[model samples]
Target: MKSEKSKNGLYSHFRLKSSMSFLMALLVFVFSCSESDDGQMQGPEPVMPPETSMAPDMSMFDDEGGEENRVNTIQNWAYAAINVGVYSSILYSHLIVPVRAFKVTINQEAHFNEDAGLWVWEKSFEVPSRGTFSVRLTAEVDGTDVSWTGYVSKSGVFENFVWFDGTSKLNGESGKWNLYESPENPEAWLSNSWEIDREVGNGNTSFTVEKEGNHQGSSITYSIEKGADYDRTVLINDVSNSNLVEVQWNKESKFGRVKSEAKYGDEMYHCWDEQLQDSECP
Candidate 1:
């Protein structure tokens, strides 16, 4: 009877220990599952998108209407006239012989007509021994060309002159001008002027003048060619007739030279030095 009781006690103890171990395992599994559920309740991390850029505003370049275009055209015409008129005054005043050494001051006035959309500019200057010179330029709205008129008064005599763009006839004379540009040299430009059948002393005369220079520098060179009948006199001086004349000058140095061979055995070879004094040709 004692042996049987001991066996029963041992069996009961083993069964109880096994039951407690199973309970512990069940508790551990329940806790782990609860933690997993908590994680599932929270959604996936937020995904960031890429940034984008904005386009530029191009409204400033757009023309609002035809008024802006018209205004721009008028402004361009006026500016071009101013430039050409100023240069022409300087060329005729300082580049030509006889009065090449004189000092000149130019006064300019500009006006615009809003109703007619026209631009007019006047430049006046005095040349020693030559009297007063006035140049007037007029341009219509959107016109491709400008009309120029010049007047000179000396002593008591007044003379009127007009310039021809080579395509137009002025004073029964046809004159033309050509502007040249060099593709290889951006600083170089040349202009040539020609006139045929220009009334002079007794008959008509033909003349040509070429100006070549680099705007980047202060030096310019000119070549003049002329042809006229024996009975005809030159328009410039009326003293002599010439076939060819060459001139060169440095505006910065305020020095220049001229060489000419006249038809009547008169030859002119002069150089204006930096001192503004006439000197022997170099």
Candidate 2:
């Protein structure tokens, strides 16, 4: 028969083993729902079509206008048109940085966030001449609609800068991205927000720049149609003067035209040649 001291030692050993088993089971339970992709979720990151596919090519006019005397000075028509063109190009140029940050995840790996039950693609890196940035893209599927969000953070600058959030069909045929300007542009148009509606593979995209608060009714509509006659187009609506100024051009040849009801005093297209000098319409 065992002595009483030996019986107590046996009990202590049993209790220690039982406690360790319980701790191990608890750990397994906790990690069972941890973040890891194991073939039970959607595919890779939501498709982010290249920005160049829709970005307007207005650089053709970079070499035009601003000439005092070019033997082509009809009301400085080309100059007026170039002003509008410059504005159009600048509107979207600011967004390229953040947009590209989100696109970098296209070839990278993403893990399923089991806690959130969503596929998350996130990155933190430095962009040459753009400083450092962190971007997150979350995608969820509810029915045929794929809701995607692009959130960004700049080190020592800002966090949760929602660059864009929009939805698209599962097939990626059509969608719209609501784009917001970066904090770097402190003087951006007051309460300004941009919307881009695109039909992928169709070369169809529309842009709308809007302002809120005290600057109401100052919205502008612009577009770029690749195969159309006037491929580069910027339409500015002057609500105060009840005028419409349009700037259009071809990317390859830089041949373009402009017109404004208020300034021009008539409905006629002011033409410009390949050299961006004033030209008589044929």
Candidate 3:
């Protein structure tokens, strides 16, 4: 009987040990599975931000800037040709340089900021002396070549001295301004009433009939700084009562239509030079 009891106790101990070993193994497996699942849930690899490039150095472009570029890069006018001159007369020397009329390679693409608003037609020209000059510009406005003309009523570089004799006869007015042409040339005219407008440095000046109505006759006499003995001409014509009248330059003279430049650090009358860098004009 003692031998049988000892065998039963040994069997029981073996069975109990096997059950505890199995439970320990199962807990270890569960912990390992939980750790693996947590690692997978963390997500994909992180992405780094892109690096930025340094700013470029701009000193090279500054070296090429100069007055020549500013002067030559004048906004070319959009037209076949521009007509500029002073009226022909002895009072105003008849300096005639024919206006070369030609079209640019491209029309609308050529423009500059002289006025600093919308681009307007611009050109570069030179006169031999200083005097009163008139410019009659005919350009293609709205794709149509219409003559939109204006004049420089005063003197400018390469132009000096001016003597203009103009006459006007009003419908009801009495005596006219008896004007005479000086430096007498082939063309001359005598007038009763005349008006001349002059503009100095910053102040721009223009002239026209004061009141537009039934006027008898009107004339314009341009007096340049230099010219023949009496090279004066008159543009006398009768017109119906209207504010808008067709006027002409008494003579054809050379005019300088340079590109407009920035007017910095100055007033209109006392501002910068044509290029607007500094006062280069003497």
Candidate 4:
């Protein structure tokens, strides 16, 4: 009987211990599940996607209606009208002759006028930018090929007289003389002749004492040197009505060459050959 009682007590003690361990494990599992649920609720509020910045469009500037296409016409300058013909010959590739000296290039529609004409273009040109440019002029004169080389020094200024013969000697006298249409080949004239107080006489050519009413002072007598060269130039005593001066020039061509007659206040200057002419400046 005592053995049986001992065995029963041992069995009851084992059963109690196993039931307590199971209860502890169940409590731990419930607490762990509750903590996991709390962590999930606290996670960062669905991160609002970072706001993206948009770039402004440039489509408005690309409009074709507002576009402008400019027209460009280029005038070439083949040479720079230096005051010296020797210099011009060196600078220009063409032969420097007495005939092809003073000239300038103009646009096709331009025409030269005698009145208030100070080497200007009849029609103006629009320059795209300022820079040195090559200039050339070509014209068929009676089937003869005539050409000139020059340059455009200024963008706004029209290409005018080359600094050949006329510029060689007469930078001071430039703009003081007038260029007119000549009856013949050289095709230009200068007027305004007067008599000076200085006595200039030659045995060959006679200066008749006559009243020059337009001259502001007393009529003076002076003679130009008599020769074939002098035959082309007319002697004058005054030019500006106050100063005594001599006017000398010939007709446009070699054959019909005669001393130019001054009509008082009119002075002649060579347009095409002024660059090859003698310099009045020392």
Q: Scored by CA lDDT, what does every candidate get?
A: 0.33, 0.60, 0.26, 0.26
Ranking by TM-score: 2, 1, 3, 4
Model 2, TM vs. native: 0.63
lDDT of 4 by residue, 1-282 (tens): 899989999888989999999999999786654334324211111111100000111111122221121111100000111111211232122221111222222223333222322122222223234333333322211111112222222345444333211111111111111122211222222222222222332222212212233422322222334354423332334433444333232223222111123322434432222222222321
For all candidates, the clash counts are: 2, 0, 36, 34
Error of 2 at 69 (Å): 6.5
C-alpha positional error of residue 128 in candidate 1 after TM-score superposition, expressed in Å: 0.7
Query: Candidate 1, after superposition: displacement of residue 77 in Å?
Result: 41
For model 1, the superposed segments whose C-alpha errors exceed 4 Å read: 1-107, 113-117, 141-147, 151-156, 163-282
Clashing pairs in 1: 166-175, 166-176
Query: What is residue 246's positional error in candidate 2, in angstroms?
Result: 2.6
lDDT of 1 by residue, 1-282 (tens): 899999999999999999999999999887654334334321111111000000111111123235544245333222222322333343443333112211121123446544434344555566567556654433332223333222222334433333211222323232233222221222212223333333331222222233343222222222222331112121222112223443344434534444445522446545555543455656
Worst 10 residues of 1 by lDDT: 47-56
Q: Write the per-residue lDDT of candidate 3 for residues 1-282, one digit (tens) a residue.
A: 899999999999999999999999999887654334324221111111000000111111122245465344421210001101111221123322211101111132333222221122333334466423433222222221122221122333322122221212221111122112222331223332322222211111122222233433332222222243212222222233222211111123311122222322222221122232323222
Clash count for candidate 4 is: 34
Which regions of candidate 3 are displaced past 4 Å? 1-87, 90-115, 131-235, 238-282
Model 4, CA-based lDDT: 0.26
lDDT at 158, model 3: 28
Models 1 onward score TM values of 0.24, 0.63, 0.16, 0.16
